[model samples]
Target: MTAKVTLSFTDETIEDARRYAERDGMSLSAWIDQAAREKALRELFNAHADVVRRAGHDRLEKHALDDAREVEMVRSEFRGRRAAQR
Candidate 1:
């Protein structure tokens, strides 16, 4: 299911996002949605890392780095597709 909602942002931010969306060959909504999803995933990963640290895992930092790499891989894949289209 999909729902539409209104959002407001500073003019500078709106312009920046529009430029990024255009550069990525995506709609503004899609660019914002991908950013929001990445933010949510990062938050969840941080919370999990904290829990692991509390559980006496000394590799929490490494796990966080791995998570970051995963996100970057996804972004690279999207960019690759856009490049291929050109």
Candidate 2:
């Protein structure tokens, strides 16, 4: 599903986004949407990392990526279970 939204951006920001969209071979809307999605995913990942760290399972250098992946997988399963119940 796609939505048409009205958003306001400054001239400089618009120009920068246009340049990036052209460089990436995407429409302006698509570029903006992709950027927004990436930012959201980054925040979600960071939130998960904070939870893991607070739980005293913060990653060691050798397995940092693996630990993050495991956390993500576990979180995904938990989300799935909740969805099923609802």
TM-score for each prediction? 0.70, 0.71
Per-residue lDDT of model 2, residues 29-68, tens digit only: 8778767866776788688677778888764533765667
lDDT of 1: 0.77
Backbone clash count for every predicted candidate, in the order shown: 0, 0
Model 1 clashing residue pairs (backbone): none
Put down candidate 1 lDDT per residue, 1-86, tens digits, no spaces: 45699999999999999999999888888788767766886787689778878988866668666787777876786676455444
Please, what is the whole-model Cα lDDT of each candidate in the order they appear?
A: 0.77, 0.74
State the weakest 10-residue window (summed lDDT) of model 2. Answer: 77-86
